[model samples]
Target: MHHISNPSILYFGTPVVLVGTTNSDQTYNLAPISSAFWLGYRCMIGIAAHSKTTENILRSGECVLNLPSVDQVEAVDRLALLTGTSPVPAGKLAKGYSYEADKFKKAGVTPLESNLVKAPRVLECPVHLEARFVSIHPLGAETGIDQIRSVALELKVVRVHLAGSILSDANPDHVDPNKWKPLIMSFQHFYGLGSQLQPAKLASVPERLYRTFDTESAKATH
Candidate 1:
């Protein structure tokens, strides 16, 4: 049975990412965002048009996407209603968000220095991707364009950090899906990945064959 429906927001399950950036004051800011996806070594993250993270990334030109596992849900929860922007923006304030001067402290997460970017990585997270801002794509704007509610940032991953526990025992370079349980967000609720139902036909293709320029670029980068 299928019927046309209009949902207020479409947030189908997606892994949660703690985006780390350097605020203008040279302080660190970590913001948890769920609207993110990857293609090859490039990722697109959707965020509020006026978010402090956005401002920081725009100014710093780099960030760290920290992937917290299901085990860190409590820490991620603590960051849910907090914003780094002082005097919280009207929209966020209306949604019950408040200014959080020290987001890392509020989340009870530790920050570790990143090798490539000024932004620190969340020490509690299982994976960290040091990335550079590639470009920005606006959202919620019509062709005539008056207002832009949000934006999608394209980022190129330069370096990756993975917890050994999440890596495949036989292939340390690869992450074991069964061992990695990412924190997922769906319709404003948190969930963990379930056991795999079945193998996919796509598995027939060698993962190495999909490597792109970004992968090579990562190798050449310091």
Candidate 2:
């Protein structure tokens, strides 16, 4: 049973990324965003044209993408309605957005200095990626709406920082899937990954081996 209806928002579950950018005064600005994806060492992030994060990234040419776990959803939600822009755009104001000068303090997240980038990383997040901004491409103009316009930024990963708990001691390159629980945003609501139902047919690993690693990771996390 499926019904086709136009929806207002298209955010149907994506990992939340806390983007850290440098402000004009050399201070760091942390903004929560879900419009991001990675392929190999390159990543693309979609940011609103009026956002301060977009402005900072364009000017600074660097940023840090912090991946928060499901347990940090509360902190991510606290930053939802806040904007780095001081005046608070009229459209954002109508949607209950407010000016937040110190977003890191308001969200109760600690800032850690990054070695490769000027933008600081969120200490609470398990994974931190230091990236160098490459370029920006304007998108979403077919709707004939100015407010809906966004810029897609291309970034090259320079360094990756991960928490030991989320990594596998046996293999440094692999992340223990069972130990990492990324927070997902489904139509503006927060969610965590559910229990595995079945093994994918296309999966390269054998079922028995997959189960073994899954069980081991779960035990290690506990």
Query: Which 10-residue window in model 1 sums to the lowest lDDT?
Result: 213-222
Give residue 186's lDDT in candidate 2 (0 to 100): 86
RMSD to the true structure for each prediction, in A, is: 1.4, 6.7
Show model 2 residue runs off by greater than 4 Å. 142-148, 201-222
Q: Candidate 2 versus the native: TM-score?
A: 0.87
What TM-score does each of the candidates earn? 0.96, 0.87
* lDDT string, candidate 1, 80-115, tens digits: 989999888898889999998898988899999999
Q: lDDT tens string, model 2, 8-91?
A: 999988899999999999887899999889866678998887799999998899999999999899999999989989899998
In candidate 1, how many Å is residue 107 off? 0.9
Candidate 2: minimum summed lDDT over ten consecutive residues — where? 213-222
Candidate 1 has a TM-score of 0.96
